[model samples]
Each structure stands twice: as structure tokens, then as C-alpha cells.
Target: MHIFDYSFLDNGLLPAALTNLTANIYALRSASGLRREANPKIFTELEQVARVQSVKSSNAIEGIITSDERIAAIVNQSSAPLNHDEAEIAGYRDALNTIHTNFKDLDFRQADILSLHAQLLAFSGNDDGGKYKQNDNLILEIDSAGKRRIRFRPVPAQETAEAMEQLELAYMEARGNANINQLLLIPCVILDFLCIHPFRDGNGRMSRLLSLLLLYKKGFLAGKYISFEEQINLYQQLYYTALQESSRGWHENTSDYAPFMKNFLSMLYMCYKELDKRFAILHGKKVTKKARIEATLENSLTPLSKRDICAILPDVSPTTVEAVLGAMVKAGKIRRVGQGRATRYIRT
Candidate 1:
């Protein structure tokens, strides 16, 4: 049996770099809390934007996708799923909604985990939704030539139940320990759950869901206003590379958790920074809608789409945003990249 122990987190095992990263994340989290308290209404718009982005990006990560309009409709429950992909997207929306609404009462217990998986596949009507895999599964990678190779072997089916039980217990114990930082313990638990691969499907999505749940429960509420999953989707290569690096030597319990831990922390840090930036653009001394739009594009770490600009400046109408963007492009102050749905603007 593979044993799960997070006692290392209480010790000096984390690298200096990770420690500093966590400190920065903590400071940002605190600042974000203050900002939210100052004006909760401003974040209401951000919450709506993040909800759509979270549903889209989390499902998109597993290759489940639909049109952006359809995704927004599904997430908001204004339309029914028209196909298998849409159905899966709806399931994720339901699961994410449950966490965002009820995370205060949720825990890392096996039953709660099972219930979440059930909600995750509620629309698919799959019998395996709330159950563990009855057979072993492999994490696979496909090469360019279409060759499939086993990336990692998860816990055997017979041992999965016990493994999950132990995982829950380990997380509960670590969470209860004041000596442990919940930030560090979160990634370890997620990595272990992935190694277990409790379900035959939806393992990857569940891990992301659990990531938000745990973070929210521990006062890291940045995911609520900024899509943590979107950040991961944007930097997917780094996300997978971190998971691969940390999942090594797992069966015998010698795997290093730092890679995934750092990745997780970095993602949270980005979410907080993003939340701060969005709020700053709205509340800063820009004084005019056009100036705010320009400031948004100027300070953005990534390119901004028209819709993104509208979200950041909810008071600004889309028509105004479009006109301003066109003017900026014509003036050579900003450059437009991609086309149509992929179009985004960046400062030149």
C-alpha cells in the first residue's frame, strides 16, 4: 500500500523560492480581501466574467469544448446541451457552481469527493459518475505519429478506494495541523488524487475543481474573481510539465511535490495579480473611459480581447470599446492580433 504523508510540509522541506512565492501570494490575497471589502459591487462583474471563463477553460483543458456563445449559454443555463461535448460542459458547470456556492461546507472527505464527481457528470447520465474505476487506468501521451505511450500508471482499481480513504485522511490531518501551510498542502493533495485516478473519466477536471474548492476554503478567494483554470489553460504546457515532474517516483512515495506546488502557487499568484490589475484599472486615476481602456491594454500582462476590455470596464458599452479600439489601432498606439473570434489587442 502506498502511504500518504504531508508531514514534510511542516518541516523545512520546501525550497526558498517556493517560500518566497507563497509569501507574495499571501500578501496579494490579503490585499485582494481588502479591495473586495472596499467595494464588493465592482467584483460582481468580475465574478460573472470569471464564472464563464472557469467553466470554459476547465473543460477546454480536457478537450471538451463548444462555441464561446454556446459555452456562455450553457454556463448560464439559458440553453440545453445540444451534443455530447455540450453535455459534458454542462456537467462541469454544475460541478463548479456547487463548489462556488457551497464550498464553505464541503470537505476533502470521500463522500464529498464522490458527490462532486456525480455533479460533474450529472448531465451525461453516466453510471460511473460517482464511482471509482473498477479497473486500472493509465495516463497516456500521444506523439505526433499517433503512437500512444503510457505516461504513468495510476493506482490499481482494487486499491483506489483505500488510496482515496488514506488521501482524505492525510489531507484532513494536514489541514488540521497549524504547523502546516494550507497553500503547500493543497497541491500535494491534488497530486495524490491524480495519482490515484479515482475515476475512469473526468480525473483531470475533478483535480482542478478540487483545487478551487480547497483554495476557497482556505481564504484564497482569488479564483472567485479571476479564473484560475483559465490561467492554467493559458500556460498549459507549464501546468502539465509541473504535474509530470512531481508525479515521478510516486508509487514508492519518493516523488518531489515542489514542481506542482510551485505551479499551483504561481497560478494563484497570477489570479490575485490579475484581480488587482482589473480593479486598479477601474478605480485608478484614468478619469475617462478611453484612458481606462488604454491603461487596461497598457498594463495587461497578456493581450486583451474586446470582450475582455468590456468586462474590465463594465460601465463602458461594447460599442464604445470597439470604437476606441479601432481608433487606437488606427493611431498605431495598439496592434490587433489574430482575427474574428480570436482577435485581441495589445499595446504597440
Candidate 2:
């Protein structure tokens, strides 16, 4: 059996990948700065929508079952569903808001990440929130015939804590080394933590939040403007397949994280690429009123009516605003609220 070794980091493709990634990231940062100035409002609206979607998908993956209707209601009506699940969805929103507000200044410890997990599961009435699993855990596979099967199981409970501690130590060591690429280290840490399966529930959601926090620490603030969760949600089957591939033979003590790592890198690159496209559009000289409105809604605190939006830009004609709103509403990018004079508009 080929036992996977952490020391493989000394020989893996990580260094070459990190160097290339760093260069790309630097270029991306420059492009993003230019976009921020060129179309500030659109960028802001995109960020807001991204943040909300990220939180929603992250929670949903853990079986929280947040519906599109519930999310739409939250945004449009400030009204929440009366059901228990809806309450949990509301908690997710609250947690996401807290994370966003403090992400700029916060640095997380292992305990902090665990606590976030607890908060994430609290809405689902899972009491193990913020606590590590005390018993042995297993990943199970169920076939179409509904046969019970064990996929992967962690080490004995006696060794679980020590294993987790070692993982955390590795994470901290990499985090403190300025020479190490934070992006590479973050996914590694997340992979290892998931392998550990420390918490009884909400492990998946917590791992994602940890990923965001790590990215934020590395100055990947653009993630807050876009979601890894949204990407994962769309490719959920692929996501699970990658995780399974990485963990295959883990019970036999094999180390093969290549598939998982590759998937993660691909997702990250996709986000970076998308942001690049948006930046390009922003910097282009032929910006339309529709584009400007999109950016403004992305950044706006309160959804605005056409008149309210026009109030902000005295230079833009009301006819232009009306035209842009009509086009956007047609495009399904913005939803109109109320009728006639009492109407308002918000990003959809």
C-alpha cells in the first residue's frame, strides 16, 4: 500500500502551481482595482448577491433545505417563513452577515472554526455545534437497492483528537510561513479537516466557511464578491466525487488528495476567471446605463426605485433610467416591486 505522506509537499507540483497562481492573482488584483473605479455600483451589487448566494448554498449543502422562494421572500419582503426550516435559513443569513461584517478584521483559531460550525448547525437543532465528535464517524454509501455500506471511516476515537491536533498544527505552521502560498495551504487544511470530520454535523458547511475565512486572510476578498459555494452547488456531484476520490482507501491509510486538490484549484480558477471578465467589462469605455444600474444595485444598502436611482445621478436623464430599468426587468436581472408610482426595483 502506498501510504500518503505529508512530506510529499517537498516533492509535489505545489511549488510550480503556487508560483503560477501568485502571478495570476497579482494581475487579477490590478484588473480588479481598475474595475472598482470604472463601474463601482455594478461591482458592489455583484458582491452583495454573491455574498447572499454563498451563504445560502453553503447552508443548503448541509441539508438545510433553503428554498428559492424563502430567499426571494427574505430579500423582497423582509418576511421569513414560519416553519422551523425557514428559521434555520434565517440563522444562516444572520451568521453570514456577521462573518461578512467582521471578516476584514477577524482571524480564526481552530476553536473559532468549530464555533462557527456550531452556529451553522444550531438552526437545524443540532446540539453538537462548536464541539468535536466524541465517537467514531463513518461516511456511508447507499446503492439504488438501499443496501447499507461503509464508504470511509475515521481512525479510532482514541487517536482522533491527536490526529486533528496534528492537522491544526500543520495548518498553523503553513499559515505563519510567509513564503507559503496561502491559497494552496488553505485547501490542504480544508481537505485534511474534512478527512478528520471533527464535528458531528455541519462539517461540510464549516469547512466552506473556513475556506472563505482563509481566503479572506490571504487577501482574496473577491471571494466575498463571488461564491465558491455557488460553484460547488452547481457541480455538487463532481464535488462529492472529488471528495470520494481523495478519500478512497483512506481507511487503509493511503494518501491521495490529488483529485480533491485539482477540483478545488479548478473551482478557484473559475471564480478568478469570472471576476476577470467582469472587470474587463467594467473598464471598457462603452459602459451602458444597464451596466451602471447593475453595479449600483450590487453595492446598494437599500433597493431603489427608478426615481430613487435617478436622484443619485442628476446627470443621467429620467428617460434613460426608465429605459435601463425596462431593459433590466426584461432581462430578469432586476425585479420590480409594487405597481405604478409605488414601484421599487432590486437585484434578482
Candidate 3:
């Protein structure tokens, strides 16, 4: 039986690095708030991009995937799911939408969790939705040679209900106390949920959906305009390393929360940073499109791809970006690296 208590967070047990990350996120949150107030309409496009990215990336993390065109159509409800994978993708889109629409009224209760799981698998028609697992499960790791090993043993089905009940109660109790930072609390609760592995299926995806719901409820709105799941998917190896480290000794209540907390906060910080870039690009209507593209490349800390530039400057046409990159490359202001889909540009 695992016990869930986040009161340890109140004692300033967080490492200095995590504390800095949290503080940075808070500062970024304030800036994000001001930007939202200043340009509310600009975020509509971002919201739409994030919605598709969240659905696609979250499912991709679970190995559920479809073509980008089909995913966009599925996410927008413009096309019906044409395969099993697309069906699951549609289900995640709906579940994410439900959280976005109704998070204010939702709680950490078992019923709420079950409902979200049910919605997550509804399109795929998994009967296990909205129900606890009736059998035990294991988290397995496979090596390159295809050998499988038990990564972690989750709570038995017989004990999952009681484990979940205690987890929700503990989370709510801590969440009510002002001493506990909700940012820190969110990861802890999510870690426990993964450890419990309540549903036979959809546990990973449900954790992500609940993460968005909890963050929204707590005023971490970066995920609304930037896909947190996409960030997780991008840094998936780091994500799993953090989860693996934090879940060690989780059953005995000796697990350390710092790894996962740091990773989680870092992802949120990235979302905010990305939002800052998006806002900066959209805010500069005075700059010419070519100038903006040039500046984006020159100022980037890493190389930028045509696709990356297009995403960062969503209002810009790809053809225009392509032309600017070509002119810049010819002028020796920037250089192209790699070729084809692997292509990227950097300041010369």
C-alpha cells in the first residue's frame, strides 16, 4: 500500500535548482498574464495549434499515431476516424477538450478521474473506460534486442480503489493548504497516479490529461496556448528518466519527487518560453515578414527549420519563409544545414 503525503513540500525540501525553476515559471506566468490581457485575440490561433499538438503528441507518446493531415482533421472533427489509431486519437482530443472546457468544476475525486478515462477511450470503445482494473499490471521496459524487463510493479487491482481514494484525499488536503505550492503538488499527485496505474489501459494518456486539467485549475495557463504534452514527447527520454528515478521506492513511500518535479517544471517553463517567442513574433506587426524571419534565425539559440519558423510565425506563409531563407542564404546572412526534411538554417 502506497501513502500519498505532500506535506514534505511545505518544509522547503525542494532542491535549490527546482526552487529557481519554479520561481522562473512564476515570473513567466506573470508576463504571460500581461500578454494575454494585451492581445487576447492573438491567442486564438495558438489555441488551435496547441489543441492539435496536444492530441497528436500525447497519443504519439503512447505509440498511437496517424498522419499529420488526418490528425488535424480528427482533432477538428472535420473527418471521422478511419482506423483504430485515429479512433484513439479522436478519443484523446475529446478528453482533452472536456478538461479544457470543464476543469473548473472538476476535482481529484475518483469519479472525475474515471470519467476522464472513459472519455479518453470512448472512441476506441474500450469497455475498461470508467472502470478500475480487475487484474494486476506491470510497467515493462524493452531493450534493443527485444528483451523485456519489469520496470515497476503497480498496485494490484484489488487495492487500486483504496489507493486512489487515499491519493485523492491526500492531494485535496494538501491542495487546500496554502503552504503547499500547487506547482509542486501537481507533479506529486501525477506521480502517484502513474504509480497506482489505476486503469488497465490509458493510464499514461490519462495522467497527461489530468496534468492539463490540474494546471488549468491552478492558473498554469501556458499549456492552453502551448502543448505541454508535446514538450514531454519531444524530451521523452528525459521524461522517462525522471519518472523512473522518482518512481523508485514509490510503493514503500521512500521515492524522491525531485527528478519528476524538476522535469515537470522545466517542461512548463519551456511552454512559457515558447509562448513568449510566439507572442514576440505576433506582436511585431511593424517589422516586415522577411525581417522577422531573418531576426528569428539570427536570434535563435539553436538552428531553426523552415517548419519551425512557420510554426513560430504561424501567420507567415511557408512559401514566403522559403523565399526569405533562400535570399538570406544567397546573401550569406544565413547558411543552410543538412538537406531535405533534415534541413535547418542558422546565422552565418
Q: In terms of TM-score, which candidate is strongest?
A: 1
Model 3: which ten-residue window has the lowest total lDDT?
299-308
Backbone clash pairs for candidate 1 read: none
lDDT of 2 at 199: 70
Per-residue alpha-carbon lDDT of candidate 1 for residues 1-348, written as tens digits (9 for 90 to 100): 678999999997679999999999999988989989998888887898899889988999989987778988998899999988998999999999999999999988899999999989988878899999999899999999999999999999999999999999999899999999899899999999998999999999999999999999999999999899999998999999999999999998889999999999999898888888888886774588888988888876567788878877888999989999999999998999989987989889
Supply candidate 1's per-residue lDDT for 37. Answer: 92
lDDT of each: 0.90, 0.67, 0.89
Candidate 3: where are CA atoms >4 Å away? 294-314, 325-348
lDDT of 3 by residue, 1-348 (tens): 887888899998678998898999999999999889878877876788789889988999999987667887998899999988998999999999988889999978999999989888888878998999999999999999999999999999999999999998998899889988889899999999999999999999999999998999988999989889988997899999999999999988899999999999999999998888777877896899988898888765345678767877877899999999999999998998888766889888
Best by lDDT: 1
Q: What is the TM-score of each predicted model, taking all chains together?
A: 0.95, 0.73, 0.91
Residue ranges of candidate 1 with Cα displaced over 4 Å: 330-334, 346-348
